[model samples]
Target: MTHRFVGVGALTDVPRVAVVIDVMRAFTVAAWAFSRGAERIVLASSEEEALALKAASPGWLALKDGPPAAGFDAVNSPGLMRSADLAGRTVVQKTTAGTVGALAVADAPLVLCASFVVAGATARFLRAEGREPVTFVVTGEDGRADEDLACAEYIGRRITDSDVEAGPYLRRARTSKAAGELADGVRRGYRGVDPDDVELCLEADRFDFVMAARREESLLVLRPLPRAAVDDGGEERRTARR
Candidate 1:
């Protein structure tokens, strides 16, 4: 297996497995929702599609960041998802970077979504599968999305170098420009923004499951690949606990 890291602009060039990283809360929210027992998440490339999906499914919830769209059930906040009772419910998510990036590479043989929260599990999944020509998609603008890049690099390192410490990467993510923007937004009382969400996003390997995406009809659906499928003798879990 080969690993390559690239920005969102290179998403179309991905050949096989693609892991999309959106550390500034998109994939972080998804990870929290899955941990809270969400059945599956449908990633929409646009707000309209997300609302439509929610409307079609009676109990499904629609979530996104930014100013509220009329039909969205809630803002895409990791803190809110952490406390949400999402048991057995499907979610429709549309985001600026993460979800969009995943869907853009939906044609790949396998697509996984990651943030700091699921970094280790994702790496374990990749190593277990041994898929060739894997690409890590940083879902931020090239050179401007430090948080996403940090997560991508961290995942790559975790897969190729067992002794790589997550400390430096997590620090980079916490002090990144995206984190600073979130801090400023929370300070100004920006809607759908919270400092606790940033704290949640920065927690490395918070989940032991991988969020894998599949294209179903017109939607890209994400569900957790449980620990049983990704673990290499529980090493990832043990390291995460430490």
Candidate 2:
């Protein structure tokens, strides 16, 4: 199987099987949301659309980061997601990088969201499905999303059955430009931004299911793939959904 890494700007060139990486909290928040039993996540391409979707659905929750969008339920913080009572609730998510990247490649036949939290499971799912010629969309604008690039590399290594020790990648992510900005934002009391978000986003393999994206009316719906695990012989197995 061939694997290529591309930036968000390489939109028109995205292929049939693609994994979008947003390690500095977008996909990380998404992983946490799924872990907390959120029914599903509707990804909005923009803040306005996210707000409109949440407004239209009375019980839906709106999540994003940076400056507050009026009427947003919460900022896209993994800490908040971990503690949220999201059982059977839907989340409308808009983010600068993660959601935008996923929507940009929505036409791909197999589009999965990725971050450190679900990297292993994503790789396992891809391997089990025999997906070929995969493209990793780094999502961060330009080539500066170091954390995301690191996660992509980690996932690539996992897919290739290579030495997948995560120390180097995690260290790189912890010290990346995005991580520093996140720290500063927390210190400055950015609303809905949490001080622990960095560490939360770095928890590799925190969940054992892949986040698959499917197109819905005016939104991309994200749901966790059924639980996947590797057997002793390194073969993939599907287990009952958790």
Top-scoring candidate (lDDT): 1
lDDT tens per residue, model 2, 164-214: 798899999999998998899889988777879999988988888888887
* CA error at residue 196 for candidate 2, angstroms: 0.8
Give candidate 2's whole-model lDDT. Answer: 0.82
TM-score for candidate 2, residues paired by index: 0.90
Name the lDDT of candidate 1: 0.83
> What are the runs in model 1 whose C-alpha is more than 4 Å off?
12-14, 232-242
Where does candidate 1 have its weakest 10-residue lDDT segment? 233-242
Q: Quote the positional error of residue 154 for candidate 2 in Å.
A: 0.5
Candidate closest to the true structure, highest TM-score: 1
TM-scores of all models? 0.92, 0.90
Global Cα RMSD, each model: 4.6, 3.6
